[model samples]
Target: MQSNLSSADAVERIVGFFEHLSAADLVRIGELYSADARFKDPFNEVRGIPAIQGIFRHMFTALEQPRFVVTGRVVQGDQCFLTWDFLFAFRSYHRGVTQTVRGASHLVLDADGRITLHRDYWDAAEELYEKLPVVGGLMRWLKRRANQ
Candidate 1:
């Protein structure tokens, strides 16, 4: 990872970094993001490399076999959009069943090819709450009531 990387190279590196991300790879987070990078997903919002690293660390702690499968990517200059499926099983419950959460990330890369802005978009209610054991029932009921 270099600061002079082209946008295409940067995007490719990001996709590959996520698809093969592991706890061991957490040490290389700075290779993908700038020191002052800002990251925001449905659950958390933080800036800087350490805070972003904490998010990934928490993911590994809270989920079982958490992984990302990138489906598509679009790049325009310094901005890139990636569509991906996040697959994981709950460590607390439903340990045998893997869940998929479809989402997209909007990223802005710095001149050095490191991510300066990372924002993830997804439906927390439909993708997450609807998959929980107890909350799933209530979420489904609410969805059906709203649809009707």
Candidate 2:
């Protein structure tokens, strides 16, 4: 049987687990997630453990030295809100350029202290689209026009 924990302990454990997450961690993801966990981010949405692991696997494949830094967090009841930064260098397209995306996650824990729903919120235009070579130019132009 899975062990249950307090919300605070669960949050702290999760933060520690995510700080060094990698392809190897996928196998142990169930340590923190229920069987039906759902995860969503700016680019992808998936449910279940395998789907969630695939997302991280793609992250490793597409980015060099990608990592997550938990800047802060708040846990209340069965829900936790976490603010974080994703740092990585594009493996091909934007090679050599280090990218950082500031974002937040809303996590819901089940009675067994396993994650049930994890949703990430970030600005694609400012954080991702603006970093691309061509799209960035157009995005900046649009921003300037809107401001003026």
Error of 1 at 143 (Å): 0.5
Give the per-residue lDDT digits (tens) of candidate 1, residues 15-125.
999999999999999999999999999999999999999999999999999999999999999999999999999997888699999999999998888999999999999
The segments of candidate 2 whose C-alpha lies over 4 angstroms from its true place after superposition are 1-4
List runs of model 1 lying over 4 Å from the truth: 1-3
RMSD of 1: 1.7
Q: Candidate 2: TM-score? A: 0.94
Tell me the whole-model lDDT of each prediction, alpha carbons only.
0.94, 0.90
The lowest-lDDT stretch of 10 consecutive residues in candidate 1 is: 1-10
Query: lDDT (0-100) at residue 34 of candidate 2?
Result: 86
Tell me, by lDDT, which candidate is best.
1
Count of steric clashes across candidates, in order: 1, 0
Per-prediction TM-score: 0.96, 0.94
Clashing pairs in 1: 3-112
> What does candidate 2's lDDT look like per residue over 1-148, in tens digits?
1346788888888999999998788799989888999999888889999898888888888889898999999888899999999999987776877899999999999887789999999999999999888999999999999999
